[model samples]
Target: MTNTKTNYLFFTGKGGVGKTSLACATAVEMVDAGKVVLLVSTDPASNLKDVLESPVDENIKAIKGTNNLFAINIDPENSAEEYRNRVTQPLEGVASKGEIKKVREDLSGACTTEIASFDEFSRFVSGETEGTEFDVIVFDTAPTGHTLRLLELPAAWSSFTEENPEGASCLGPTSALKSGKERYHTVVNRLRDGSLTSFYIVARADKASLKEASRTSNELKELGMGNQQLYINGVFKAIDKQDSLANEIEAKGSEQLKSIPGNLNELPIRTFPLLPYNILGIDKLRSLFNPDLQKSISESTVAQTNTPHQELTGIEKLAEELCENQQHGLIMTMGKGGVGKTIAASAIAVLLAKKGHEVLLTTTDPAAHIQDFIQQLGELPATLQVERIDPKVETQRYTEKVLEHKGQGQSEEAKKLILEDLKSPCTEEVAVFHAFSKAISMAKRKFVIMDTAPTGHTLLLLDTAGSYHRDIMRNNMNAGRLRTPYMSLQDQELSKIILVSLPETTPMREAGSLQDDLKRAGIKPYAWLINQSLTLLSSITDPLLKSRASAEAEVINTIKTSYSEKTFGIPFIADTRLLPTLLGNKEKV
Candidate 1:
């Protein structure tokens, strides 16, 4: 591994695919080779500090295990606050104090948060900020969709600036329109000229993740930001004869790897063996990072076999519970971004639709991949109606409506401030609540299946539901336009929550948190689906995968006992593409 370069490396994939761990390992490797490295995590629930076993806050701090390695967690909210203050500082002379307060509140929305985070990230990646002297910078990103959206912000911001160049520096829309263009352009130019930037799409050997990785690469290439590599993390082949579970996992993983999507076949692919112990802290990670350990693990994994077929008893039981209440029910799949929640949600929707139920599949995830999967299904029984709830569009419309209603005879300044407020992170909550409410209403008519936002956002959205409902009730009583038709869809009986996760620590922990959040919202999950497990299939001889595969059994059982009346496990497929045959025309399974 060469360590003389100052390239910016970003690791992203489906959630729980070991992106953070791999990023950490890479950073460690670089630091070990006498290079200064900065490891950053943009994910809200980033476990970077935990993995490094160091106390990492928003600022950079030296990592314990290495001399030149440092870690940082970029908090978007803080950055957004700073950005808001900067934008509003110049506006104090042009607008009244009250107007300035309103402008600040409005600028505090989700859009600003996203932009602020991107701004910080760009600074680091382009070496325009401090720590530029580091030999390498590695970023552990959120899921694929969120990361892509975050990366695309500079382009979006550029458009915003072009449309309202003069308003960019001011507190409201007019000022944002006037001065925003220059700020956006500066960031864009920095990104385009950054020759040291590199992106690594991390993925498991499963069909869904591999396909996602290929699609992500294609999307980035189209965007003219295609300096990339492919890292297939956690490739399990098999282990000792006594470990039947290990053998089965390796066999399944090998089958899937061989059938990787055609689009990703040519990319530089690196494989990391599944380690025996959890890759939590620096000590354990260092052991896995050792070249000798990797080689030994690889050899041992390749020499074992005798895997067993996994039981789908949990899924069957869950299906029975779902079918038990023939009454119209709603099942929602929710978690952090890029955790395969959409895939899992679609699987459940398809499974139910095949069972001859009137199923309506809907998603509030900004990056809805379900449509692609559905189209790939070719002709299906029209029993399933898939709809996507776009937060950006919905929020924009809602903001326009609010301005129209509240600023009927106000000055352009007031209207602009209202529009700015509409861009805040809170606006997404309002917009999502509208979509979610509409979805919940549908539960009264047909079986509703939903794919929700990631954990933090989802919780915030749910929390807003109660306040929203109260606000709507009060407004209706006072003769204001009734609440949007979508805000009242939170009935417990009509909704069944399904937490989707992998049989790994991070995802499982996140899934558990999701369950807790839902319960706090007076919503209880109907079941938990553990996606892409190798333990359920036949055994193989790869020691690396064997150990990892065996480890999944305990996690699976834990999920089965903790979540619901039943738990489901979807085995890792041989190919990333779901052939027409597997989608099954009859759908009784």
Candidate 2:
């Protein structure tokens, strides 16, 4: 039987879920089927070139040995520039001289960057571009939250246009929406049509990623995006039955796997075995996508073993710790990219709220899915307030205020330069730090849970504290007037850091580094939460899983020893961690 499906696939989930690898594998599969395929990555950190083992850049490049396969990384900034020109070109003739300049400035905002990228994305989805002849088009997306926002932009932009029917042209709102109506409608229609698009929530076979996928799936469904398939990647199968460590790990993994949560179980679940080799190059990806090849590889390498170890029940330990002291402070979750920091943070927030603490859950992570996760909570108690910090908005407000203080007569070029400087990563850190300070202030009254950015970003944010301190000292009297009241608070008394990690080697190592970094900055963690360990609660049966579990035990011991007893572990949950209804049945302590 011939498969006649028009493949327009989007891979999204929590960060670090192997979306890029899966997208590459799927595209390679289509290419091997003698079909033309285009793999496009919309992620800022596009690893398509790394995965394909080719030097592909912003433009489309054909993969070697694959006649029908091509890949491209869509540069959002370049797309935004082109879009700005296109929008302004027609307005030049109709708009008055002064109006044209103003329109150009308005279009230069950060929103323009987002709109431009969405426009490029829409062209592919709507089949409006020259390369629309491909039999399949796969998008290797960023994390779930950003991708969803990008997908929903057409509707948002449409609403904005409708509200201000006059185009935001130099002509002072006199420009008609009719001018852009055709293009706008085309993009909106493409996004809404399920027949033309399908999404796969790619995830690791761990509690946090699985929970995030389930939550993201529900949010997308509510947003009218079609239900997504659940692609569970990195599943470890037993290769050696005699190895106790291996068996113990697999047994634990199996327990979690068998108990697939309610929200996730209904979706078509596809499993990919854990591979010894990194899925970076195209050949490896091609091999990974081949069913027969993968099956043979999995069978040959699978190990079964069990090991003895003391386990730490994460939630129980956490509950006990929290109950011992109902002190108000901040619990910040920090980690590397794609390591489930946001989900871990959200889980902490939910648990604290359930325990009757007035909690304000917030995140400074540039790519956070906190909102999506919280929406699944379904009517949280009045004491729980979940909010997201938009760095862009904060930066914009800061920029405008500074400009107002600088006052008029600045040349357009100078103004543009100033705005660009304000949009720099450094400025973003400052803006986020200002907000962080305010949130920390609120912890004096209630529990504040922060889902911090990735390690590098968090370091930059905390560095701002020192810089602000220096700036304040330099301008003593003036500093007092400019400084926010929140900046004066000490970190130790107001905040408690929580390092979150999985049982895997990479995550644990990263978490350790995060702790060291925070400690060096004089920020000691109150506790550490090791998330999604099968070995923590059950015996493993797969050799590889057992080894992994053993490794985790070592890490856990290290954490316990190093942190002096402020470490906890949250075991893998069988069911999806979506709605309260789904997660209501608490696991036995």
Best by lDDT: 1
What digit string (tens of lDDT, one per residue) describes model 2 on residues 1-589?
0142645788998777788788888888777778988888876445577678887777778888677888888876577667667766787778897776556555544445555666677667767667437888889986665677677666665655555465343212313222354566676665456776678888877666677787788877866776468898877666768756455546666776876779889888889877644565666777776767755543454433234565665554564465357657777787656765776677767777777888898988756668866777767877788888888888777778867666477888777655544433234445667788888778878888889876545654665565456546555777656543224333655666777776555456557766776677566777777776656646445455555565566666766776435766666544444434224533632
By summed lDDT, the worst window of 10 consecutive residues in model 2 runs over 169-178
Candidate 1 lDDT by residue in tens digits, 28-109: 8788778888988887557787578888888989988678899889876677787787777888789999777766765644
Query: Model 2, 369: alpha-carbon shift in Å?
Result: 8.8
Against the hidden true structure, what lDDT does model 2 obtain? 0.66
Clashes of 2: 37
For every candidate structure, what is the RMSD over all alpha carbons to the true structure, in angstroms? 6.1, 10.1
Off by over 4 Å in 1: 77-109, 126-133, 165-186, 239-267, 287-289, 295-313, 323-326, 336-340, 354-356, 366-382, 387-437, 453-490, 516-526, 533-546, 553-589
**In angstroms, what RMSD does candidate 1 have relative to the true structure?**
6.1
Q: Which candidate ranks first by TM-score, i.e. highest?
A: 1
